[model samples]
Each structure stands twice: as C-alpha cells, then as structure tokens.
Target: MAFIGASRGAAQGRSASALAARLGFRIGLVGLFSGTLLLAALLLFSLQPMFTKRVLPILGGTPAVWSVAMVVFQALLLAGYAYAHALTRWLQPRAALATHVLVLLAGVVFLPVGMAKGFGAPPAEGEALWLIGLFLASIGLPFFALSASAPLLQAWFARSGDARSADPYFLYRASNIGSFAALLAYPLLIEPLLGLDAQARLWSLGYAAMTCAVVACGLRLRNAAPVAAPVEAELTVEASPRRRLAWIGLSAVPSALLVAATAHISTDVAAIPLIWVVPLALYLVSFILAFRPAQPGPDRTGRLLSGLQIAGTGCAFAVVVFKQTPFLLDLGLTLGLLFVNALMAHRAVYALRPPAARLTEFYLCTSFGGMCGGIFAALVAPHLFSGVYEYPLLLAAALLCRPGVTAGGLPAVLREARRSAVPLIGAFLAALLALVARGPQLGIEVLMVCLVLTLAADWRSPARASLVGIAIGVACLALQAAVMAEGGNHRSFFGVHRVYTSPDGQFRLLVHGTTIHGAMRLRDDEGRASTGRPVPATYFAPGGPLSDVFEISRRVNGAIPAVSVVGLGAGSLACHARVGEAWTFYEIDPVVIRLAQDANTFHFLSECAPDARVVQGDARLTLSGRTEQARVLVVDAFSSDAIPIHLLTREALAIDFAHLDAQGLLAFHISNRDFSLSHVLARLAAERDLTLLQRLDPPRQPSVGFAHSPSEVVLMSRDPAVVREAKAMGWRAVTPDLSRRPWSDDYANALEAMRDRWRELLTSAR
Candidate 1:
C-alpha cells in the first residue's frame, strides 16, 4: 500500500521531463536555462549580505538604508525588465545570447566578491552622488545580469519551446523557488561555513556553468526557431507594460514593508546572531506561495488574512503609540502583522497573475513593487518618520490596498447587529483621555477598565476595529511616541538613538541599538570627576574605556597616552585625559561632534581633554592615512544598527594595530543587541597574533569580565603579558579564533557562523 501510494503521488506530479523529451525539448538549451537561473539565484543570494555590508557607509546604516536599498533594487529591477523587454526586438536570439555572454564576462575586470579598497570612506557626504556613481559602477553589471535572469531565461524558454504549446509560467515559479532557497541557505548554511572569498569563487563557478548552459540554449533556439515566427499562446488577461509596472509596484511595496519590519524590530533588539534572515525568509516564502497557481486564487485567504493584518497593525501601533504595551508583546504583534500582511498581499498578487504568455511581464512587475516597498520602508521611513513607526505606516498602506476597510470602530452594518446593554465607544474614549491626562495607580487602573470596555465593545469587529481598540487599550502609546520622538528618540545612520526622559526629570539615559549606552542623572551630568573635577558621562566617563587610553599609556608608555576614538560620541572621553596627554578623535558624523560640543548639552572640552583633534572621516580609512601613534585605541565605531563589517575585519584591526605603539592596548566596544561579537574578536585576535580579554564594568568600579554572557568590551593586545594582567583582574581569556578565518576588507562573512550558534541562542526563548 505504501509503495502504491508513493507511485501514485509521483504519477500525479507535473511530468515536465517526459513531456519535454516527447516534444523534442532541446535538452542542452533547457539545461543551460535552468543552470543560468540557478546561478543567478546562488550568486545574488550569497552576495546579498556582502553587498549590503559594503554600502553601509553610504546608506549611513539607518532603517532608511533598508528602504533606500529597496527602492534602489526595485528601480534596478524595472531597468532590467525594460532591458530584457527591449532586447527581444532589434537583437535576434543568437545576438542576445552573444551580447549577454560578453557582458557577463566583462563584469570580471573587477572580480572577487569583496568591495573596492576605498569605497566606504567618509566625508563622502558631500560627494554622495559621486559615491553612488562609484558604487553603481561596481555593482550595476552583476546586479543587472542577475536581475535579468528570470525574464531573459523565460523569454528564451518560450522562444525555443514546443510548437503546439509552450508554458513559461511554471518555470518562473521554479526560478522563484531557487531564488528563495538560496536566500534561506545563505544565512542558514553558506554564510557560516564560507568566507566572502570562498562564496564569491563558488558564485563565479556557478556563473561559468550558467554561461555554458546559455551557450547550449542559444544554439538550440537558433536551430529550432530559424527565421520562423513563434505561435502566440492564448492569454486570459492581456495587460499593458504600464499595468505590469503597477503590479511590480504593488509587490515591491509589500516587500519593502517586510524589510522595514525586519530592520526596525530585529536589527537592534533581537538577542540572536545574524537573525535578520528570518523576516527575509518569510518574505521569500510568500513568493513560494504566491507564485504557485492557487486553486480558486489566494483571494479568500487574502481577504480574511488582510483583516487580521489590519488588527495586528492597529494593536502594534497602539501599543507603541499609547506606550503602555510590553516589549515582548510589541514584537509579537509586529511579527504577527508582518506574517499576515505578506500572506494577504502575496496571495493577492498570485490571484492577479495572467497565463504563461504574460507570466514574465507579470513577475517583472511584481519584482518592481517589491523594490518600491523596500525603498519606502527601509530607505525613506527612518528619515521621514522620526519614530520607528513603519508598522503603522505599512498598515495604513495595506488598509488603503483593501479599499473601504472601515477604521471608525463601528462595523459598517451596525444596525443589523444585536443590541448591547449600552454603547461604550464614547465612554471608552473619555476614560482613556482622562487617564492619559491624569496620573498614578488610580488613573492607570481606571484607564485599564476603560481599555477592557472598549475591547469588549469592538469584539464584534476585531479585524476592522483593531486600531480603535488599540487606540483605547494603549492610548498612552501615542503620547509616549510623540514625547519620545520630540526629543527622547533620534534616528540617524548610526542606528536608533533613544534618550529616555525620566518621570522625575532628574535623569537622561542614552540607549543605542539594544543596550543602554549611558545612564546619568542631572547630578552626574552636571559634575564630572576622576581623582577630582567635572567629567562628562557616557562610555568615556573618567573611569571608562577612554580613561584606559590614558591609564594604559602611563603604564605602557610611562608619561601620557595619545588616544584615538574612532567615533567621538560627544567627545566625552576627552575629559578623562591628564595634562601632556595627546588625543585625536576620528568622527564619521560631523553633526554628532557639533551637537556634543554645543556647550549646552554638556561641556567636555572645558572640563576634560582640552585639546582633542577631531578627524572627520571613516575611522578605518582615516586611520590608513594617519602617521600618528597611540598607546591605546578604542574601535567604538559601532556606528548605527548596521554593523560596519569592514571595521571588524582583520584589515581594519591591523591598521589600528599598526597605529598603536608596540605593547599597546586595543579596546573594542563590542556592544551589540544581536550576535556574540566576542567570537569575532577571538577570530580576529587569532588571525593577527593578539591576546584578548572580555570585560563589563559597573559604574565607578574596576571593570569585571564575564566569560559566560554576551554584553562585553574586549581588551586585546599584541603583548600576551598585558592580557595576563587583565585576566588576573577577573578577566577570563575569551576563546578567540575558535570559528573560521577572520573577515577582512576584501571579503568576510559571519552569517553561517552565526547560524551554527542559533540553536544555542534560541534555546532560552524556546
């Protein structure tokens, strides 16, 4: 019975192989086509992380980068679509084949998977246009070829297909499956096991194989379609190019929305390693479900799921806006909303798809939409919307997509509904406003009661009335977000900079990414002291990492420490130096220095290291040109949520090491919400023959190093004896270079490494 069932299932499956053979399918051409498609997927997926990492300095690593990249990608996709479309005419099939092959080969003049030597250098803010041009020069061809795969191959397949019947739609889905698999596989397997060099080589080999395949496919097409007009298959729906573009926009928007959600929610908060892939995985899965032909179309599910999305969106925003929601619940709401939104939007796209004749055009359009969504959410949102309000904005967009989906908290057909004892909508609103305007347990408890009443009132239309209920339940969220945005929260290329204002108005705390960077009360903020005098608060507060620059120099160099801070966050560390101490600060954002030295925020120049020189550029590149030397250096250039992968590379560290006097100290502020970077330091130290110690020091005390948990500042040195000193002070020697090779400017990938460690991290949550 089991054998029979298996055989039966196999028989029912689409028999493309036998059908092709029967129809005299040019096996070589088909093979080449499939190979090329696979190659494109593999190359694109493998290089995504590497490429995304390279452009960070330009994009400035804000949530906006995701949006900008998305838009940029979508626009690229449209160009590719237009290119392929244009190529079908003027250029014969053989000519197209010859031209594309030559183009692919030409991209190699700038070979290997890594970025150029000086692509990410700062002060490019003024030269951003030129920077983009340079970046495009580097990435355009590879991206163009890879982007052209689906449509180009599909067109090739159609032109060489069976005389009586040719189906291209199914092949598009196959390509999609391949692309998605590669996307998941990158983080899940490839990135962890392979460095960027290896991955790039592997991709090149795949492209080579694809090139061979394209040769055979083109030969087959020339032989078969010789001066003959191809038959036009009957189409159920014929859409203009412009309509197709709309389809692309539709898909791109949702895709970008997904990216934004991932960036905002997990970028700085998820205490997991390289977990950015999860949301992207879901996004790809939507393609799997959406591209496949639905039985009655995905509309039924789309409509139902879309409603739930609205609810999820409303609740999520309400939680944030009202500021009364738990953090975990907030994340859960976001994830839920995202999952549902993808399903609904993707299924809607699947439903709108035409037959095989228009399939490539359809997919081209879908890809276009995905690009748009990505740009809006990833690039535009962070800059445009002061708060991380992407969820609400996406939800609002989704609601518009659904058309006539009511948000007034009243079901459209309210007259037919069963009557309750009373209407609490107005009462609910009144109570919420009163509670928000008031204070203490009395007000909060009363507000909670009102929240419950409003939820009950809207129970009839949970899907449509979610936003209203959210408004009531977490009405304080709006106030919190507004207050937080006005002054407390700031978004920049460096990530989410959140400064919380305490109810007492006596303290201000700076939270970057996921960790609390500084917590200084007015008393602490106002006065600074080391062995005496006022000091600015932050990581460089008199006794912190900055002070180590001076203290270590005295111990190692004897007189004073010439220190360099990669990121001069308010120049607070300058105050820690004693007289005759020389210090140079490398700051990427001039705006940060301007604000820090504003005198109103907190004066560090008058209070601390009075004559600090600020070098305005990327620390990595700037250090490359510096002739100065430091006894101690801190690579706290953990700019933005987007980790400057290059700075963490062996090349960057070696440069820092070069600038250091022998027997000097290199302190790396390994503060991150996701991934234990200690492993990374361990790897870097091993590669460069250095010793390392991980430390976490509480305020006004000697630093304590913990080997067990993640939050740490790594102290490394070429001198093993100095590391021994740190270990004697409770600093456990962290295991370095236990993973693979260290990442470098040329190429580096820790995705696969992070993936391997996933089970360990997820265990706690599980």
Candidate 2:
C-alpha cells in the first residue's frame, strides 16, 4: 500500500511540471511577437522624417515634399500587405518563412539607408512623379520589407496555437503604439540628439534586431498546425465585396484628412517635421483606440460621433470668421477636429473588421484605401482643384461615415435627400443673396443661421446631417472665395499664391498662406500712378534693414558690381539694382515668376528688373553652376513666413559664400512671426569664423505712398570691417549661444530653434 501511494504522488508531480513548461513557452511566444512588431513600427515611422530631412535640401524645403513622401509610403504599405496575403494564401508555413527571410536579406543590401545617387537633378516639371521615383529607388526595398512585418507577424500569431491566437487583432494596437512613440520621439529626442548619419546607423541596427525577432517568431510557430488545418472553432465567414468596400470607405476618410490637415496647419505654421508629425501621431492614436479588444457600446459611439461632428462644424465656422486664425488656436482646432473625426471613422472600421482567417486581405483593402486617399490629396487635388477644396470635401465625407447612415440603401438616401432639400435650397438662396448684395457681414450672418438650422434639423439622422453638413461646408468655402474674389488665385507645387489689393486700396499685395509676401504701392492718395521709379515697399522699404545691407556693402566695396537674389518676391529687390550692375534672380516656383512678371499685377519685375536675368528651379540646385561672383547676395526665400532651413545650413552657406566675392556681403531676410532666425545666423557665423550683424527695424504707421512693415535682416561677411561699418549704422553685433548647436545639412531642430520665441509668446500672454 505504501509503494502504490508513492507512485501516485510521483505521477501527479510530473503532470504539474509539464503544464508549467507549456505555459512558459506560450508566454514567451507572445512576447517575441509583440516586441518584434513594436520595433518594426518604430523603425518604419522614424524612417519617414529621417529620410525626408535628407532630401529636403535636394529639392527646395517645401511642405509639398512631405506630402509626396506620404504617398510613396502608403503605396509601399499596400504592396507589402498584398505580398503578405499572397504568401499566406498559397505557401506553406515553412516556405513562407523562407521567402520572407530572403526578402529581408535583400533589403539588408540597402542598409544604413540614405538617398540613392545617380538620380541627378530633379526636373523642372512633373516633380511629383520624379520624387516618387527617387523614393522608390532609394528606400523602397527596406521600407517594403519592414511594412510586411506587421500583417505577416499577426497572421503568424493566429496560427501559433496560443490561447488568444484566434483573435489577433489586439496585436495591431501594439504596432500603432510603437508608431506613436517613434513619431513623438523623433522631433523631441532623436532629431535634437543625433545627426542624420547617426540616426541611419542606429536605425539599421534596430532593423537587424527586428529581423532576428521576426525569425524567432517564425521558429516559435514552425511546429504548430498550418493555417488551413485549423483545429479550434472560430469565425470563418468569407468577406463579401460589400464588407470590403465598407472597410475601404472607412479607411479613406482619415487618410485623406491626415494629408489635408498636415498641409493646412504646416502651411500656416512652420513646415518643420514637428508640425508634420502632430497630425500623423493623432492618426496613429486613432488606430490604437479603434482596434482595442473592447469598444464602446452603440449608444456611447453615437454620442461620441455627434459630439465630434458638432465640434468640427463649430471649428469650420471659426475658420470662416477668422480667415487666418491665430497659429496656436488654428493648430489646436485643426488637430482636435482631426483626432475626433478620425476616431469616429476608425471605430466604424473596427466594427466591420474581418476574422483572423481574412486578416491579410482585410489589411490589404485598408492599405489600398489609404493609398487612394494619399494619391488624391498629393497627386490629383492640386491639379484638379484650384484651391484646397479636398479638405472640406473629405470633412463632409467623414460625417457620412457615421453608423446607421445608409441603413435604408438607395430608398433611404432618397428619403434623406427629400427631407434635407428645403433647408439646403433655402441656404443656397440665402448665400446667393449675400453674394449678389455684396454684403460681407450679412453673408457671415446668413452662414451662421444656415449652419445652426442644418445642425438642429434631423440631427439624429446621419443622412440628413451629412447632406446638410456638406452644403454648409460648400457655402462657407464659396463665401470665403468670393470675399477674396478680387484676387487671382494660382496653385502650384509650392502653395497657393493670391494677388489682391489691400483694404486701403493703396497697395497691391502678394499673399502666400497668411503672410504677405510683398506689397507694391500702385497709386498715391489721389489715386494716380506715382511719378518716380517704383521703390521696394513693405519689408523692402527704402530705410529698412535689407536696404542698409546694400548701402553698407557699397560703402565698403566702392561699387556694387553684381547682385544675386535667392527669392523673387514681387521682384521688389530688382528696383534696388543700379545700372551697369549685373543682377540675377533665382525662383523655384514658376507661378510666382509669372505673377511677378505680369505688369498688371505688380511691375517690380517687369518695370524695374526686366533687364535682370531670372533663373528657374531651386536656388540650391540652380546656383551651383553660376560663374559670376556677386558683391552682394541676398537670401530672402520664403514659403509664407516659414524659412527653408536647408538654405540656412552650414553646407548651404558654403555654397552661397563660394559664389560671393571675398569682400561680398551675405544678407539673410530673417523676418518671421514665430522664429528668431538671428540666433541661427549668429551660430552659423560663429562656427564658420565669420563676422555677423543683425538689424531689427520697427514698423511705422501706414502712409499713403508706401507702407513700411517691420523687417529684420542678418548680415554675414568674411571681412569684419564690412559688418562693423553696418553695425555703426543700425545693426547690432549678435553673440552666438554656445549652449545651442549650429544647424548643418546633417542636423537641425526647428522646434528647438523656436523655443525662445515660444517662451516670449507665453510670457506676453501671461
């Protein structure tokens, strides 16, 4: 009896040991997959800003460059998802693993990623296509390989025999969290700490580590049952076409809005990576919230959607009232609208998510939708619409994505249209009356009434709400367009350029985004053309700091022989050109040149600089082959108030200095609302052992002849005497802040550079 009892105890101990070992293995598998996904997403997101920063100098540092880059990424993501779907559908587990590993190894050849050489200079036209080709050739393989990892790994986990393998959508949350972390860390941590080369090296190491983790994940699941040989009972419904279309529609709205919002906010604020990341970070956060294991109930989702819709409509109203809102408030409103609207749409997407068997297919459809949205925003919209009409259109589309909106199909849609027709038609007539009467204030009041009525009418019916919301949006945009109808709108790869007469009707102003680029005094107080040669107005007023740079240069050098200007803003600087002096202007945007050359718009270029040469293309690319040395070089290039950091970097300065005579003066127009660029210029001068002087001229009250706006100019020279003489006039010798690093082609931190200005703003607000 004692021997039998002992045998029973040993058997029970063995069984317990086996159970513990199995539990440990399962936990290890989960960790490996999760960690691999996290690392892969980090590398994927961080690569965007890193690689784009490197290319900004190649092209001019325009925000449009970032838009095109997003399109490439979305396209690559779709391709990666399709590849994953194919592998899972046709290949066995071991074969699929081998294939993916080989693809990753192929990607390794492009490690330590940077732009590919031999692409040469980009074209004057078709820049979008050229840029797309460049990205594909340079970073395509590595990015493609990395993009496949998320879906492939999730699919792998589905077949891994783990307890939660039957529902692998939870892993998606981990992927986006990594994405969010990477985006936040980039501007805040990585950009401030590491140069581009260092970032590339560290990223390559992370990629290699992630690859090993992916391989380990494959090994962990090698002996498990094949995907086709499913054992446990689970959801197996084949995704119908209608369901696939629903997924696509739900995904497209946020993706398009992501691009549109980025463009809108960045155009007004600075077009730095930090601004670009905010919208994208919110977008990823929406995905994280949407794909969570638990979601809100139907009633809760409906309330959330309604709240967001109302808030978004209110924001639209604010945009109409203040054509150019305060930068910070505008940014907050834009991002808030994006987050709420995206969350609502993505929640609907998660509701229609397919089961584990169709995971890759589901991802493929979603990615394809994203690619479509990006394509529309980046490639098509600029050519199709004269203004940023896509933004409002997408906003309206987002409202339509609310739940139960299309429950009654075509018949339901007809009923909603009938119900909404009276209000919509009434709003249209009211808008027409406002336009015909030419009453701006009355137009605004009518818009307010229409919006309120629309929101209050059938607020519960998504169809009625969506239709009226679109009408309201269209009316608002149309009203704004009419208000600016006196101006001619021109769209280019760069941005919108509007030429309009000022409210006082004394100056013809050229505006980009919210900032006035140049203003020409067209008529005196008597409403007649001025007699003498047209003088540069606005920032280029006769007594301004920019004029002082030329005066001091002429004083030191005896006579200014040649002059080169980087930005051709109304060609105002051309009037400053003296006879017998060779003057050249380098302009990137063809549209700006056209407008400046049109004598009807502003005659600074045609009337004053007709004899001057104008070079087309980015100054960085166009100035490299210049033969003549200039005694004075002015760098006044700007896309709105945002200065191109590439043009201010050490490498860029070297190029400018190379084209300048030894005694030549280099003047940078540093007038900006958000940044104190004197700090940047001071550091650059110190690093290069050059002398620097800055002058900040305060604004004068508007006069009838020429309005003198505030201007700031920083002058740099190899000759100390030149800058010293300028200092005697009105310029102050600036000291470099040793605590801050100088910007270079390899490194820059626009956010950190703006820290002082931000502090000043906060103090003033307080």
Candidate 3:
C-alpha cells in the first residue's frame, strides 16, 4: 500500500511539472512575437523621415517631397499587407513563417540604409517619378519587409495556441504605440542626439535584432497547429464586397486628411520633416484610440462627440476662411478637426471589424484605402485643382462618414417631411444667399452658426444632421473660394501663388502664402498706367539692400557686371540690371518662371532684361554646374516664409564661391518673418574667412509708383572693398556667435537656429 501511494505522488508531480513548462513556453512565445512587432514598427516609421532627410537636398526642400514619400509608403504598405494576407491564406502556419523569415533575411542585404548613389541632379521635369524611383532603389526591400510586420505578426500571434490569441486586433494598438513612440523620438530625441550616419548604423543593429526575434517567433510556431487547420476551431466570416468597400472608404478619409493638413500647415510654416511628423503622429494616436478595446462610456457619448466634431470642423473652416485668428490658432484648429474626424472614421471601421480569421483581409483593405487617399491627395490633386480643393472635399467626405447617417437618411427625411421642412429649407437657402451677399466673413459666420444649431437640435438623427452640416460646410467653402479668389492664383508642387492688386490699383502683388514675393506699381505718381521701364519694387525697391549690392558690384567690377539671381520672384530684380550688364535667373518652379516672364504680368523681366537667360532647376544643383562667373550672385529663393536650409549650408556657400569671380559678392536675401538668419550667415562667413555685411532695410511709406517692403540682405565676399562699400550704405559688419555652430550639409538644426525669433514671434502674437 505505501509503495503504491508513493508512485501515485510521483506521477502527479510529473504532470504538474509538464503544465508549468507549457505555460512558460506560451509566455515566451507571446513576448517574442510582441517584441518583434514593436521593433519592426519603430524601424519602419523612423526610416521614413531619416531617409527622406537624406534625399531632401537632392530634391529642393519642397513639402511636396514629403507628400510623395507618404504616397510611396502607403503603396508599399498595401503591397506588404496583401502579401501577408496571401501567404497566410494559401499556406499552413509553418510554411508562412518560413517564407516570411526568409524574406526578412534576404532584406538584410539592404541594411544600414541611406540614399542610393549615382542619382545625381534631379531632372527639371518628371521630378516626382525620379524621386519615387530613388526611394524604391534605396530602401524599398527593407521597408516592404518591415511593412509586413504588424499584420503578419498579429496573425502569427492568433495562431500561437494562447487563450488571448483569439482576438489579435489588440496587437494592432500596440503596434501603433510603437509607431507613435518612434515618430516622437525622431525629431525630439534621435535627430537632436545622433548624426545621420550614426542613426543609420543604429537602425541596422535594431533590424538585425528584430530578425532574430522573428526567427525565434517562427521556431515557436513551427510545431504548433495552424489556426486554420481542420482540428482547430476558428471563427471565419465572409467579407462581402460592400463590407470591403466600406472598410476602404472609412480608412481613406483620415489618410487623405493627414496629407492635406500636413501640406496646409507646412506651406505656412517650415517644410521640415519635424513639422511633417506632428500630423502623422496625431493620426497614429487616433488609430490607437479607435482600435483599442471599448471603454465604459454612455451610448450617447459617441454621438455627442460626433456632433461636436462636425460643429468644430465647421467653425475651423470659418476661422480659416475669414482669417479671424492667428496662425498658431488656425493650425491648432486644423489639427483638432483632423483628430476628431479621424477618430470618428476609424471608430466606425473598428465597429465593423471581422473575426481574427479575416484579420489580414481587413488590414489589406485598410492599406488599400490609405494608398488611394495618398495618391489622390499627393498625385491627383496637384494636377486636377489650382487650389487645395482636396482639403475641403475630404472634410465633406468625413462628414458623410459620421455616425447616425444612414445610407438613405437624407432622402428618407426629405420624403417624410416634404410638407413641414420645405419652408425651413427655403428659409435656410434665403439666409445663405443673404450671407453670401454680405460677403465671406458674414457668410462663413452665419453658415457655421447654422450648422452648429442644426447639429445640436437633431444629434440623434445622424443623416439629417450630417446632410445639413455638409451643405453648410460646402457653401462656406464656395463663398471662401470666391472671397479669396485673386486673379492668377495657381498651385504647384512648391506652393500656391496669387496675384492681387492693391486697393488703389497702383500695386500688383505676387503673393505666396502670407508673404508678398514682389509688388509692381500699376500706375505712376500722376495716377496713370505708365508703360515706362518697370521699376524694382517690394524687397528689390530702389535703395534696398539688393539694389545696393548691384550698385557696389558695378562700381567694383569697373565694367558690365555678370549677375545671377537664384529665385525669380516676378523678376523684380531684373530692373536692377544695367544696359551693359548680363543677368541670369535660376528658378526652381516652372510656374514662377512662366508668371515672371509673362509680359502682361508685371513685365519686369520683359521690359528691363528681355534677353536674360532663366534656368529652371534647383539652384543648389544648377548653380554648382554653372561654369559662368558672376560678379554678383543673389540667393533669393524662398517659398513663402520657408527658407530652404540646404541653400544656406556651408557646402552650398562653397559652391556659390566657386561660381563667383575673384571680387564677386554673394548676397543672400534673408528677410523672414519667423526666423533670423543673420547669425547663420555670420557663422558661415567666419568659417570660410569671408567678410560679411548685413543690412536691415527699414519699412518705407507706400508710394504710387512703388511699394517699399522691409528687406534684409547679407553680402559675403573675400575682398575688403566689398565690405567697405556695403558699410557706407548702412550695412553693418556682423560678428559670428562662436557658441553657434555653422550649418553644414551633413548637419543643420533649423528650429535651433530660429529659436530666438520664434520666441519673439510668439510673444508678439499673444
């Protein structure tokens, strides 16, 4: 009896030991899969800004570059998700794991990623395609492999035989958390701490680590039964065509809005990746909130938030249209609208999510929608519309996706209330017409207020409320278009340009964003439209620093001077060219070139220097290849208030020097409302042992023949006579701040360089 009892105890102990071992293995598997996914997401997101920064100099520092890069990423994401979906559906667990691991291993060959060599000098035309090809050749393989990670790993986790594996969608939230963390780390921590080379090496090490984790995950899954195998009970549902389309529609709105918001804000501000990441990071946050497990809340809470979203978006549109707020406030409102709208759209998608068996399919559809939205916003809109019509159109689409709006809600409402609602509708239309007559300010205000009241009164009826909201919003947009319509308004890859005549019709201004690029006098002092020689206006007005540079150049050269102007802003500086002088213009945007050369539009180039040569390409690339020597080289290329940092770097200065004669002066138009570049140019001049002269021209009273705008020009030369002549004309010798490092091609901190000016701007705004 005693021997039998002892044997029984030993067998029971052995059974307990086996159970513990299995639990440990399950925990290990979860860690391996989750860790791998987190790392993969981190690398994937961080690589975007890193590689784009690497190639920004090759392209001009246009915000369109980032937009195109997003389109590429979205397309690759769809391909990766589609690939994962195919692999899992066709093959067993072991086969899928093996194939994915092999692909990852193969992708390692593209490690330590940077821009590819031999793609020198972006072509003047087809730049978008060239940029896309450059990205594909450089980091395509690794990025594609990494893009497969979120959906692929979540699918693998579902098949891992753990109880929690039944719903793998939670893993998606974790993935976005990783992505959000990475984007935040980039500009805040990584970029500030490490150089690009170090960043590349570190990313390579992380990639290797992720590969090993992936292998470990694969090995764990190798012996387990596939989730879709006959023995395992898996929940599967048929994804109907309508359901797939719904998924695509819901996902596309936020993606397009993301690009639109980025473009809008970046055009007004700077075009750096740091600014680009803010909207994207918020976009990821919305995904996190939408996809996470439902929290305890009242049923009406979501409806209330939805109503608020619509009202808030309408108000934001009004504020933007009327220019009633500061830039920062406008930016905040735009981002807020994006966040709330995205949350609503993404939540709708989460509500319709299929079971784990259809996980890959759901993600694939989502990626496809993202790709479509990106293509529309980044590719199609630039070709289709002369303004940012995509922004307003997507906002309307988002209103349609709001909850409580049934498919036939508006039609049903109209049919049910034909008798009672007809007068109401007619009254609303009359009010809209009255507001339109009053002008854009009153129109937007009345429309926004009407939308808020309409939404508030019928919050429960989503369809009725959404219809009213969308109509009001669209009407407001139409009114805004009319109000903001200045003749010759055009949009390009760079930014939007508008030509506006001043109130007295004496000045015709070339405007980009809020900055006036050039102003030409339409009528003379005698109030006649004098067709004499075109006078230099705005920053190039007579007695401005730019004019001083020309005077000094001609005097020092003792002959006809060869002048090269980097930016062609209505060709205002062309009037500064003398009869015996040679002038060439290097302009990046073809639209600007066309507008400047048009005889009817300002005609400075045509009237003053009709035979001048205009080169169309990035100045950094085009100027470097020029063999002709310039007695004066003017760097005046600025898109709105955004100064391309690449054009101001030490290497760019070196190129400028190489293209200048022995006594040539390099003048930089550093006039900016948001940043101070005096210190930057001073540092560069000191490093190269060149004399630097800076002048801040005071604002002059407006005259009928010319408008005098504030201007700041910095001149650098190896000759002392150039500095002396500049000082005689109110230009001061600026000393370099030794504490601040000179900006170089390999390193530049635009925010740091502009820190002081930013503080002043904010303080004044308040």
Better of 1 and 3 by TM-score: 3
Ranking by TM-score: 2, 3, 1
Candidate 3: segments with Cα more than 4 A from true spot: 1-20, 223-236, 300-304, 406-460, 480-486, 524-527, 555-560, 698-706, 759-766
Q: List, in order, the clash count of every candidate structure.
A: 42, 0, 0
Candidate 2 local Cα displacement, residue 478, angstroms: 4.0
Candidate 2 residues 216-306, lDDT tens each? 8888898664554462243356788888887888888889989988988777666678988999999999899878755445567657667
- Estimate, for each residue in 572-594, the C-alpha lDDT of model 1 and write its tens digit: 56666778878888876655665
lDDT (10s digit) by residue, model 3, range 1-766:
8999999999999999999988888777777777788899899999998988888777678888889899999988998999899887898777887898888888888878977877888876778899999998899889998899899888888887776788889889878988999999998888867778889999999898888888888788876655655214444458888789889998998899999999887777777767889999999998998897777776565766786776676666566556657787778888888988888888888988988888999999999999999999998998887767677778777876775552443466565344435434654675668666985556556656665566566555666555665565566557667756756677777788888787677888888877788888888766998678978877888888889888887777676568899999899999988888899999988889989988888799989999999999898889888898988899998888877888998999999999998878899998886678888888899998987888988666554234677888999977777777777778889888878867877667777757868876789699
**Candidate number that wins on lDDT, 2 or 3:** 2
Worst 10 residues of 1 by lDDT: 701-710
Residue 362 of model 3, lDDT score: 96
- Per-candidate TM-score against the hidden true structure: 0.78, 0.96, 0.92
- Report the C-alpha displacement of residue 248, candidate 2, in angstroms: 0.9
